[model samples]
Target chain A: MCGALLVRNPKGGLDRPIALYSTALILLLLANIFPFLTLEIGGRQEITTLFGASQAMYNAGMGELAVVVFLTSILAPALMMTSSLYVLLAVRFRKSLPGVRVLLSWIGHLEPWVMLDVFMLGVLVAFVKLGNMATMYTGNSLYAFMGLIVVFAAASSSFDTHLLWHKLGIPGRKT
Target chain B: MRARDVGLASCHTCGLLLHLPASGHTHCPRCGTPMHMRKPNSLNNTWALLIAAIIAYLPANLYPVMTVISFGKSQSDTIMSGVIYLFAHGDWPLGLIVFIASVLVPLLKMLALLYLLITVQKKSHRRRLQRTRLYRVVELVGRWSMVDIFVVALLAALVNVGAVATIEPGAGAIAFSAVVILTMFAAMNFDPRLIWDYQGEDNG
Candidate 1:
């Protein structure tokens, strides 16, 4: 893990976890942009974006859960992926900063609450239950969400706290 | 066991893990009980949680997790069967996702808990490093087991039906709840401090 730090070589610094996080964050952003579903009921149609679901829930009087869903699914991932990207890129320039420990702890605490995979399950269950009662169209967004999950997991697994310190030439005795 | 050799005085009446002062042991840390090298109920409590988790895991897998009905036709799928259905229907990738998150992850947690409990009980000290890795895995993955439960709860609250298609949780819901609780208890009961303590003993 220490050797995998973003130290300069013949090529520029490219640590595995940093690379994983960048890819995951970009994928998550794309997943957010794409439409998860196109609901067609009684000749009316609306493509449900990830944001749209939260909005709909808020409109339906489940405001608290809506905020939770948004934070856990959207805001938390945004913070995680962005912070991860920041740390990884910073390491390449040997610019390690204080509070990396605190950020990693936050990531650890919030990781499970961000339930993209579970959200996918909710989508499928909605499809199966609404098959005849309502007509639903699957779209590219579903595919994007699937890809997003892999990128997210890879991003999380590749992250190593020790690597950040190592990049700054902080002695490798584990903090 | 020697107070002179280990450098901490013992209270012969009760065995408690206590913080000794610079000179010698002060008092019984817990219940004002005299102190010893080992904690009394830690091992037993961990084993109880582990056993409960293993038992709960069986029903969590075998019983129907969710029941879905469409147009007066109903079908039920347990966690394993759900994954199998996903695979049979050519949703193999999604099948893998459910298989791992809902099924394998929880079981891995149970095993991890068991391993931690046993190793702590036997005082195994070979892999302090690997034990830390396992502990993290168990702690992190513990709540993803709630993924299935969250789906169930959310859908149950969202979709209500009298004659149209409906969704209902099954007996496995209780068992799955137990899996979540038992694993959480297992994580909490297995002391991480024990890992460092045993490793120090091995080196000493």
Candidate 2:
């Protein structure tokens, strides 16, 4: 279905995923380091980093919810990008990298679990809802978060799973 | 010409077309995933998960999702109440968004799944193409329901203050998340190919 769309380039190979995953990894780091948003009310400011959202839930006794938030928004995406880069690098250099097939399988399964885009919308809703009560400020991490979303989407679209499996030379059953 | 009729099976994980072994169970040689003619117990699994989600949907809507306490004033909001609050305060776009994602999507998705399950079970041949498309839509929209859960989590995390203001996640958030997860599992366990399975029966 994807190949049918637009012009198919014979040479459109590993470069897009490699570049996008690298950029995504950097953005993921930046998103974690800087404050994501700040809520100021009555001369006091509550600063929340990207991790803070889940941390606060844990603090509030919603440990399960906190874990869900963390896994979907943080860990899943990070692992996805990292593993994709690993796979792409291995494929690009034509190295017999250890566990390449397993990693590819994991990458496929992990795709649905990454919910950064949903979390981004959550951030927007939080902003508007919080806007009614307190003064809100977007931190530097917000930009990184947005950029990560775009790059993640591009990387997912450009990374063709069929092509990768074919290139890996895993033998299919003879019909 | 369905795959199963000719003893051919495709690996769901890696999309590799392969012949089914005579033993009736095998693994995908390329991706190492277990092969099945169709997802095993697709209907039963989907029914179980869909029922659980439907049960969870009650408390998810009935209970408060979050409570905002400011200056000794405490106000609790359920999913609908939160959207109404947003709309009341003129945040129409965000309210509409919450309404669609939180309220409409879940309810409609469940209904659609229920319809698909019943249709497939009854061997209804009408609109096989549309039924297949509906399953795809259900799978696609499943994740967006997490928006409300994340929104509540973010608020509970960010709006922390000692005395001036604080937000606490309510019991409903847990139930709501359960509903979302169960429905997602329900969608995944569903086999869209069952819709097309009726083709051979209708002509045979």
Candidate 3:
């Protein structure tokens, strides 16, 4: 296990995560606001954003489903990005915020629960399934969601928890 | 003869190993976050969450996950029906993906959690390393079951062409999502340290 730990460190730095996280936040906002997928059939069209989709689910009597979707796709990701920004910014300023370590740990826990990438793949599968039924056009939010996935991935990969712990002056290193 | 027996407890948040204070200090001095020798109430919490998941799993698989209306006709499809529809339409790969991710993953996750909880409660030392790996696998794959819910949300968001076609989420989607999320919590609440507890005595 110690040998595995020694080999686990890949290249990561602070500057890149800050940039990527900022971009991810912007894209996340866009993804939530704008319509993600537009369906046109028989002269009627409907546009839906991420939140709108969850709302639709709730309105259709799947309230728990809506809550799950809303939490995993929107709430978790938003929390992760903002919390990451908070921690990374504190690190950049060379100040140990009272909750910096706690926030970082929360980010580690939140990372897996955020399902933006998988949600995007589901969008694609939905598109293919709906293709024969209606004329579907990809919306701006779809593009933003795609970008959010890439940017969020970049930010998370660039986040080094060990380095952050060291910067925060947490003692008794295992390695 | 656990690590705690040797007076060592690793910080949960920062991975720092420190002597277990005789006074039972709860906060890690290094990180200022609460520390525990093993997760508190691990077995009871896991068992509660697992039972909840098991209850939710029945309705999740039984009811329709979504309803699709097209050209004056409405049809509701259960998760199994959806997978079958995909397979019948020759989209076997997507069908298989959905089957594994939405169905298999959650069921397997619950079973794995149950197994871990049982073994840890019994303090079984056999195959300790493999049991630990299984716990890791359960933790890692727990989130993937969200794929089905995502698909439902996407389809419900899209495919809203009015009379020509519309997709609406069904009650089962919510139930299925509950099962997935509850199982995830169960896995998180589990303490893998318990898997190694019995082994320590033999090794020492």
Q: Can you give the DockQ of every candidate in the order shown?
A: 0.05, 0.61, 0.58
lDDT of 2 by residue, A59-171 (tens): 88989889889999999999999988988999889897888888888887898889999999899889888887899999999999999999999888888777777777665
Q: Write down the TM-score for model 2.
A: 0.95
DockQ of 2: 0.61
Whole-model alpha-carbon lDDT for candidate 2: 0.87
B43-71 in candidate 3: lDDT tens per residue?
99999999999999999999998999888
- Candidate 2 stretches with Cα past 4 Å from truth are A1-11, A171-175
Least well predicted 10-residue stretch by lDDT in candidate 3 chain A: A1-10
Look at candidate 2 and give me any clashing residue pairs.
none
Question: What's the best-to-worst order under DockQ?
Answer: 2, 3, 1
Best by lDDT: 2
Interface RMSD score of each model = 11.1, 2.3, 2.4
B1-204, model 1: which lDDT tens digit per residue?
233445554433322224466554355432243343433466688788888888988888788876766458888868777667667763567667667877888888887777877787688876767886788778767766655654554344333343454556666765776777677766766655465554446566
For candidate 1 chain B, the 10 contiguous residues with the lowest summed lDDT are B9-18
By DockQ, is 2 or 3 better? 2
Model 1 TM-score (2 dp):
0.53
Task: Kindly indicate the candidate among 1 and 3 with the higher lDDT.
Answer: 3
Model 3's number of clashes is 0
Ranking by TM-score: 2, 3, 1
